[model samples]
Target: MAGVAGRLARRWSWSAFRSPVQVTCSQAFPLHVSGTAMMATQADFENAMSQVKLLKKDPGNEVKLKLYALYKQATEGPCNVPKPGVFDFVNKAKWDAWSGLGNVSKETARQNYVDLVSSLRSSESTSQVKPGAESQQGTYETLVVTSDDGITKIVLNRPAKKNAITTKMYHEIILALQAASKDDSALTVLTGNGDYYCSGNDLTNFTDIPPGGVEQKAKDSAVLLRDFVNCFIDFPKPLIAVVNGPAVGISVTLLGLFDIVYATDKATFHTPFTHLGQSPEGCSSYTFPKIMGSAKAAEMLIFGKKITAGEACAQGLVTQVFPDSTFQKEVWTRLKAFSKLPPNALKISKEIIRKNEKEKLHATNAEECQVLQSRWLSDECMNAVMGFLSKKAKL
Candidate 1:
């Protein structure tokens, strides 16, 4: 009885002295005070107006509004939260885009997006080379090369910048892969000197790609990288990636084209395309989920999840994960084992495997090139590249 009386008293007081507050979607709210109804102050109206502005700008304002409505209904009597599909209309236009079924009218654009997504999902793992093989060493800018033992080792030498791949480094890699192809080496091992394998393409040259010329430049660059990957893939020997540090974007996806991969405990793998509003590259889509599972691939492609080396190994993306201290020795031992194999036999085996998938690989490469060219000029990619360049300039 006392509680009911208290509630009634408060209600009566509100009705007798408060003005009738009119709430609108805008910043301004009007209130009408009847005779003797002067209890409500200007502060009350201002506070309401501020809340209105917040609701208007909040990304989840609609959701909050629905929740509030549901709360009001429940307090008045009984009600359910608005159905989940209520907001589905807002995303209706983008439904196809998100589902990978983009419109046929925009087929080229859709294909570009699909290809980029695929590249993000691919895994580049190389076949393991046996231990005790001969090795050769080479260096270019921030890259250190160790070849011989039937394997050319290309290591990113920039530990200071986490071994990010620069334009010069990119060209050097093309040269190294070409050399490896001509050599009688049974396998090639690509890794990093210190910690990081290759963080990503250095943003320094991003601004060098001209605005209108971006598409052609992208096509040329993609062709160059594709040729490099093709050389490794078609070589008489296998190619392996020994990752010890963060492999982001292209670095993460390039491994998809390799035959086998070994990573240290400290290695991390991620594709940051979606985060940057850009797409993936390096033929990742076809290879990634095939090496890892489809679900895991989706997680990496969609959310750009950063995966630990152990997680990568468990997902079948990495051939093995070893302690950081023993990783180098173990990798050398494996490479030497490959070097002991008959070079001709290794070449024959590699040729046979590649012959089976040669057509498909070439076709995929062509398709990827087409899409990459289209996306190169996209606003999202352009803006991201520009922003990256600006940030790099500051650093």
Candidate 2:
């Protein structure tokens, strides 16, 4: 039996690189001619048995085949040409390869591999489809939409560039919010499409704004963005955000206006206005400290350290953190639930909350616009912007 097994192993191994039929026929013929049954010692038998056990237990077909081939190639020359059909060795090999026997058959390992492959394939397909899917398809660089039940979702889509607020994008956002306000939609969910929600202003425009005498242009852009933020804050009906990634600058500050905010474990919240040599915008100076304590908000605005989603939840910046995998689904589900509530009740409730703060928000926005306009032309802000661009250019 041992001799037959050894010969079968060698034939299978050689066949892996050659032809299975030829090896099988050749090995069988030699054994018939020898007329003497070759045998193996107890130790040799044990070692060969161990090899079979390993082959049966290996999870991967490629790995098992390689090991089987190697074992055959190593032992075949020294072993005898054994009798045929002694142990059904080929059947065992096939069974092991297909079954993924022993330690490799655990449910957890299989599930892990399945999940890993799913994520890899999803990412690959997304990368291939993403470039052609946006802008060229009339999707626009800074706009996204999703729908669930009767709820409609709008997202700021420039996440790779940190959803930088452009003049056109700002105007479009105001239009979207206004449309949502008028529409009898069940809910409105707003968020960013990628890793960052928004990084504030589009610094690229600064490059074209000539070295001097572009103060009015800068002010115009800042006003447009601030107006959009104000419109979003004052929009009627429920507004929720699934902050699955970073929310920086105006993005973080604007969350104060949202009815609910859900962030992911990987989400980050930051506001770096003071560090950028400019005053805060989106009325963050007042709204941020009001939502989060003055001391905590001051620390973040001054230093600009990225706060984790969990920390944001604790600080009242976000409502909660959903697992990264199901964050969006969970957020939309909540939005749909909110949408099911009585529309008049929701509208009145939201108005009551904002009635007192509306005037305050407007005043703050106007003040912020003035500061931003003045700083936009200041040497400090210009130099900082230019420096940032220079570094970005190198990268």
Candidate 3:
């Protein structure tokens, strides 16, 4: 455990460094009004509303409040209704957000709303386009999403980084899952573009510290991680993982959430959360034990053990292993047949199977993320991350 004084000192030192672009309670209103000539039109407001409907992940309570306030102000001039009583926290908060907008004109409110949505969308497009990526017309930077013949395949596209997941990739995957959930496809598949299935969370995601400090970054990341995992827990369609090669960290841990996970004979599974001075996530703490038994789960999650394809199959983490020579051909052949099954039947059957554990899985996800949020700010995690980076630099 870290000394209390040291922790206190670090928090105090970091607290004053405010994120320049962040909007807080005191700075909420008067949101960066720009040229009135270019103010968003009524059509823009409607477009923004439609875009909000398509958002996959919840943008959090604060942002929701802002959106609600902007919409009410833009459409209805100002808040005229009586504010709810003090004990009615939910309504009271909404009233405060709207009433706080004061006498802002409808045009200005619309513009601000448009700007907010644009900013939100901008954040998700931060991933750099890597070389050799065969990006489709309407695909995510870190993933290639395609639906055909009843299967929606989401392939991790950054093979140059061994398919390591970045922050943007996490958000993109959530978006892809959301799209697949509503598509005509009977099932959704997750795989990788190149040799490795997924190397795990891109370590560089930890190195960039915004002015919000480690605490704020940890909190934001925890929220993203929670929503990312929740996508799998709630996915209605059959979710299959085509583990073409190795998988690690979150990629390996999340396999438990899939209905089926097929791997190449050369593929390996690993979770090195402990090595990074972090705790288990992706609901591995709960599902790992349930799927593979306590001792084996402890070995992989608690002790950071790496297991081979055959071993993972034996432990029940993977459904089956195929030869590298024909892994894709074999997996696709089986998946195509599975996908051809009645979509509604497959969906309902999955719901029935997952119903008993849905609540538990959600609870586990919340608890694990909460623990990780704390761990991400600790000195131990920071030091371990730095050590990992230093070695990578040498390489």
Best by TM-score: 3
| Residues forming the 10-long window of minimal summed lDDT in candidate 1 | 24-33
Models ranked on lDDT: 3, 2, 1
Worst 10 residues of 3 by lDDT: 17-26
Q: Candidate 1 regions off by >4 Å?
A: 1-139, 210-212, 388-395
lDDT tens readout by residue for model 1, 230-339: 44444446778889777887888778767779988989998877766566666676677777878999899768999999998898888998898898898789778877
Better of 1 and 2 by TM-score: 2
lDDT of 3: 0.79
- Ranked by lDDT, the better of candidates 1 and 2 is 2
Each prediction's number of clashing residue pairs: 41, 0, 0
CA-lDDT, candidates in order: 0.56, 0.60, 0.79
For each candidate, C-alpha RMSD in Å? 25.6, 27.5, 15.6
The all-Cα superposition gives candidate 1 an RMSD in Å to the true structure of: 25.6
Residue 88 alpha-carbon offset, candidate 1, angstroms: 70
TM-scores for every predicted model: 0.61, 0.62, 0.68
